[model samples]
Target: MDIRVKFLGGAKSVTGSKYLITVNDFHVLIDCGLFQGLKQLRLRNWDDLPVNPEKIDCIVLTHAHIDHSGYIPLLYKNGFGGKVHCTEPTLELADILLTDSAKLQEEEAEFANRKGYSKHNPAKPLYTVRDAIEALNILEAHPFDLTFRIHNQIEVRFFHAGHILGAASIELIIYSSQGIKRMVFSGDLGPMHNPLHFAPVKPPNADVLFMESTYGARRHKDVDLEKELRQLILESDKKGGCILIPAFSVGRTQLVLYYIWKIFQNMKSRPVYIDSPMAISVTHLYKSFSNYHRLESDSEFGHHIFDAPFVHYVTEQSKSKVLNTIKDRAIIISASGMATGGRVLHHLFHRLPREQDIVLFTGFLPEGTRGRDIANGEKLVKIFGEEVMINAKIHVLDGFSAHADQDELVEWSGHISEPPKMTFLIHGEKEQAEVLRERLIGRGWNVTIPDYLETFTLFDHV
Candidate 1:
């Protein structure tokens, strides 16, 4: 028996997380994420995988985030027909995210074709809504901490990862002739002190580990989250302009809403508009899964923390467009946290030119994304095929990021009683991963920062 691993994606990059584990003839994929951010990375989504889709026996997802689970539909469309397993909440959230991703692609393709701005003769989406729906049918949900079998030689279990509703750290128990080998995959870890979700659960001892390094090089700003948010709100109000926050629909949107509601209780509050239908749906899920998060059952507002009276859920496209008419004193939250795509682009197209408006990014922005360009003080950004001036005051509140920072990541890794024989730093930019690699090496752990398409032999002649 032999065991090997391949990094199809999410090795040196922060997005598109796919890892293939091969034990003899059986192959299991850890994640099937789509490449995001830069044009170079996005183009990888269109390329054929080095391994055939049908050759993959099963898929085990860590969470439902687009970058971790977005490529399922494309793989399924290509010929892969196997169960995609995840926790119950992850299964539900994946359904929502994947469907939304498909709709956005289809809408963008059609709009590009109509406007004749796309280089492709007639722009086409990577996968259709139909494909996403078909892929979803194969999803099987499991409970956290419960071990389940995918193959005769392989068993899997999940632990709470604390980033989002159904996020998890995966542990694979492989039975080989040499002995039982344990492997752990750290899905994106959340901050230890997050108010929305519990702290990440530590993994059991492992022989091999794959860890995320999204914030490995930097520590999050040590500011009072509520105080800073209130200050920003007050400042934006004084300027008499709306605060446009580009946040992820799942985790960041809900956290922003919770804080806004808490702060608005005593102050003169602005009309808070949640402009993404997907976000609204996800907010409701937070209400449904009480066991998954740290939110109180009943808030000052009412039974649901997300049910503040000042909040407006805009589901209609016409209503979303109408938000552009409001020049001042409103708080609008939209999706595609990095401003890579989605309705947030339309919101930015209108608000970026307004000097009084505030564009607040609630989390990390990947390199080559529009959010990064705007946050880096790039004066002009191309949106909807036209260059838009960026006069709006931009602020990045890393305190709102769900990903654990450098110290917290080290603290999480410290929980392991015995060091793994090998650890691979993944899901981060090159610099961030390198920083983490050095930090771990200093602790006397064997660490490697794998490159894209890199493969390793974990066990041979077992």
Candidate 2:
């Protein structure tokens, strides 16, 4: 049989991207993204395996985003023993994100059980923090684009896809007695003109391809991110209110932090508070990677930025709760970027009010999320079963979104050597993925949008 492919994750709904590539006796998984959205998406993470995890020989991570990497710990929990390979930056970020995800999941379950809000008496976490740490123990770091053998028959390499700090597009070279074939997996692609990092690097050529459809169908508004964020910050403060930023801690938060540093350059006013407990932990990781250059601006600018006395980090639970009491208006950054869950929910429930506060969004807000409501101009946001008036200002820095737009995706593909036999679109909503698929189809590219668990065979090219 030809090489086989399975759509384990990231398909019509955009979350959970797991694909199996098997040639001869060698097998490898391209990505093990966690399905994140509503209960169904989260439950997918707990579902039994369609294929035995032990049978898989290796895993290639596209980047360190939670959806792409969150399930790794669960894989470990299930006794998958293969090495997890990624770029050095991805490895570092994955360590931070996966562990944090486990903690959050466990904490959420515990809270649910305590509050009697869960259907299950236990309401256990999908995977524990220890599981995440175990998954981390198996990671093998490699440099980008350097072909390495995961097995006797499979050779793989990674290229920077530029969606965020350590994001990449993956390429695989499958060697067989008949010939050598290639497949490419486009992770979340960063913008062509993104301010945070370099543009995404495209594939060198492949017989089969998998591209992301996160922003495939739409174009972003052309505006200066710094100016836009500054306006939001200024107006939010005009009424002496706090600014609540529900940001993806990995890419979006760092980008906002950079722009906030930029905002502080011309104007000075109230202080800013980083209230996500996980975000505080992630800040150290960001510093270690230099992903947020402005935070490093002290060194880049030849002075200490956080050294300033006003930028406060709310690490402890007590400290986070106290933000509600701080009479002064401040900028508070929280996690669970979509406001689906996380400390941001607490902030929204307690702090959001008429024009006295604001919710500044940086990433795509999934449906049925508080962030989505705010972005869609919902006047009232229901949090923890209570509707809170969105009196504070609302804004979306779409440009700061980590994923690359359509034009950028096409530009990144230029580096590929030969067209793949197929290019699958994953990790995007139906509309977004379709937008990207149509664009590629117009160019005569053989692309397919796989559904959850759909399988395919990778036939060898003549």
Candidate 3:
């Protein structure tokens, strides 16, 4: 029997995570995610998978982040009808993200066609909201730590990865004619000191390991993120200008809101508003899965994570548009963290020219993104075909990132009982992966920085 693994998407880049694992007569895909950032990478979303999706038996999602689980709907649309195994919170959050993704694609396509900016005669969405719902229906929810059988020859388990609400590291025990071998897939591992979720759990013994290196190249700077946020709010208020936060609706948005609610629960001047409908819905999901969070869901502080004296949720387009007209010193949090797309762009267009306002980023902004460009001090940016001056103060609060840093990743890897036979680093850019490869090598572990569509045989031939 031959057992092989393929690095589909998240090999040399930080986005679009898809891993295909093939065992004798059975095929399993892990982490069907969409690519973001550069136009070339984003274009890969429209490209067909290396293998036919119809032939795949099942998909195992690591988390609910768009880069880790966003491509499932597209896979389903391509004829994959098998079960998508994930934690309950992951399943629920996937529903929110995938649905929102489909809607966003449709909206972008419609806008492109109307504006005649697209090369195609009529721009088309990759998938529809109906397709997203179809994919969401097939998710099979499982709990962490419990071993379950996905096939007669394959057993699997989920460990807390701590990146998001239900992020997990997957352990697969594959039975072959030679013997049983374990393969561990570390999804996006969160920081050890994450305020919202617990640290990533240690992996059990394994023969092969696939790990993420999103922050492999550098250590996160020591900064008081909450304090910075509070200070920014106060400064913006003092200047009578709004503070705009472009956050990923899933983990970052919720975390930012949690910190805001905690820091300014008693403050009356900083009126906070969640302007993205998708983020508002995702925030509600955090309440539903109270046990998944580190804090007590029902406690006075915990129960009000999303509540502030003047906090508002702008669910309708009309209400969101009204925010652009308000010159008050309010805090607005919107989605599409990198400012790739979404209501956040509208806010950026309206507020970027205002010298007193501040544009704050609470998460990673990949290269080539508008957020990165502005963060890098680009003076002029095109929003809706109009050049907008970046007069607003650009601030990056790196302490809010969810991914584990270099030292923390090394610490996590040290938890393995023994060094695995081999480790393949994925989910990071080239320099980051190479830097981590060198670090892991120093610790006496063999590591490979895989390329996109690379393949490796996991089992020895007889």
Pick the lDDT winner: 1
TM per candidate comes to: 0.98, 0.93, 0.97
Please list the C-alpha lDDT of all candidates, in the order they appear. Answer: 0.92, 0.76, 0.88
Point out where model 3 deviates above 4 Å: 265-267, 298-300
Per-residue CA lDDT of candidate 3, range 183-277, in tens? 99999999999878889998888788899999999899998877888888888887788889999888788888778877775565467889898
lDDT leaderboard ranking: 1, 3, 2
Backbone clash count for every predicted candidate, in the order shown: 0, 19, 0
Q: What local lDDT score does residue 378 receive in model 1, on the 0 to 100 scale?
A: 99
Candidate 2 residues lying further than 4 Å off, grouped into runs, are 290-309, 379-382, 385-389, 460-462
lDDT of 1 by residue, 167-203 (tens): 9999999987678999999999999998889999988
lDDT of 2 by residue, 135-235 (tens): 89999888876889887777888887877666778878877777777778888887777655777764677777787888778777787888877888777
Best-fitting candidate, scored by TM-score: 1
Residue 122 in candidate 1 has what lDDT?
85
> Which portions of model 1 miss their true places by more than 4 Å?
299-303
By lDDT, the better pick of 2 and 3 is: 3
